[model samples]
Target: MIRVAVVDDEPVVRTGLRVILGSAQDITVVADCAGVGAVEAVRDGRVDVLLLDIRMPVVDGPAVLRQVAALPRPPAVAMLTTFDAREHVDEALRLGAAGFLMKNTAPEQLIDAVRALAAGRRVLAPEAVGQVIDGYLLSGRDEDAVRRVRALTDRERQVLALVGAGLSNRAIAGRLHLAHGTVKDHVSAVLAKLGGLNRVQAAVVADRANMVGTGPGRR
Candidate 1:
C-alpha cells in the first residue's frame, strides 16, 4: 500500500483529496493537515508521497517542500496546481518536485499518479507534459549542452535517456537490469560528463538532443 499525506490550506481541498484518495485501495491518506507545519507530520517516516498545493494561506507548498527536502527521508512531492500556471509548474520541477497534477484532475488520474510515483515514476498531466516539453525545447542555447551530453558512455546514455523520459532511479535500474547502486554511479557519471546540476537539467539536455524519444508515459 502507498501512504499519502495531503497538505492544503483550504479545509475543503484537503477533505476532497482525502475522499478521492481514500477510494483507492492501494492508497491511504495517512495524514491531512493545513499549512506548512503539516509537512513535519510525515517527516519521520510512514508517508510515501505528498500531495501539495502551490499556494497556501500561510506556508506554501514550495516552502513545505524545502523543509521536506531537508529531511532524512523526504516523500515524493506531486504539486497540486491548476493547469494555467505554467511558471509554477516549471519552478516546482526545478525545485525537485516529482511531478505536477492539475487540481481538476480526475479521480482515476490522481490514483494512477500516486501509483506511478510509488513505482518510482513521474506523472505529468498530458497537457502539462506537452507544455513543459514545448517550453523546454524552445529554451535557448542547446548546442553546448547537447555537445556535453554526447560525451556519455553507451550505458550512461541509456540511463540519461530514461531520465529524460522522467523515469526515476529505481525505474531506470529495472529497465537496465542493473543494481540500484550501479545505476546511481552511472547517473553520477552522466551528470558529471554533462555538467548538469541535477537530473532535471540532464533531462532537459537529453530532451533537447532528442536522445529520449518516448517520454514518461511509456513503461
Candidate 2:
C-alpha cells in the first residue's frame, strides 16, 4: 500500500482528504496533521507521499516542503493549493516536490497522484503544468538554459523533451522504442548534462529552454 500524509491548517481539509484517500484500497492515510505537525510526521519516514497545503498558518507549505527535502529519505511531496500560482508551482518544484494538485482535484485523480509519486513518477495537474511552463517562458532565461540543454547529445535531448512532458522512464522507453535500462541511462545523462537535480528540474530546463514542444497536457 502507498502510505500518505496530509498536512493542512484547516481541520476540514485534512479530514476530507483523509476520508477521500482512505477509501482507496491501494492508499492509506497514515498521518493527518497541521503545518507544525508536518515536520514530525515526515521525519517518522513512514510516509511515501505527502500532500501538503500551501497556505497553512505559521509554517506554510513551502516551509514544510523544505523540511521534508532535508530528511534522510524524504517522501515524495505534492503541493496542495486552492489555485495554481506561478510562484507556488516554481517554489514547490524547486524544493523537490514531485507533484502539484489543487484542493478541488477529483478524488480519483488525487489518489492516482499519490500512487504516481510513490512509483517515482511525477503528477502535475494540467493547469499547474501550464503555469510552470509559462513561468519558465516568462523568466527570460531561455538563452542560457538552451545553451545548457544543447550540451546534451541528440538522444539525450529526445529523452529530455519527453521528461519535460512528464513521461516516466517506462513510458519514455516505450515511446522511444528503447529498453527501460537504456532510458534510465539516457535520463541520467540528461540530468548530468543539464545540471538538473532531478527529473522535474530537467523537465523545467527543457521547458525553459524551449527544447520541447509545449501544450496543455503532459504529452
* Alpha-carbon TM-score of each model against the true structure: 0.67, 0.83
Q: How do the residues 1-22 of candidate 1 rate in per-residue lDDT, one tens digit apiece?
A: 9999998888898899999999
Clash counts per candidate, in order, are: 0, 0
Candidate 1 C-alpha error for residue 201, in Å: 4.7
Q: On a 0 to 1 TM-score scale, where does candidate 2 land against the true structure?
A: 0.83
* Per-residue error (Å), model 1, residue 31: 1.7
RMSD of 2: 3.2
Worst 10 residues of 2 by lDDT: 210-219
lDDT of 2 by residue, 95-181 (tens): 888877878889888887888899987777754566666545555554565688767888888888888877778888888889999
When summed lDDT is taken over every stretch of 10 residues in candidate 1, the lowest stretch is 126-135
RMSD to the true structure for each prediction, in A, is 4.6, 3.2
- Residue 194 C-alpha lDDT in model 2: 66
Residue pairs clashing in model 2 are: none
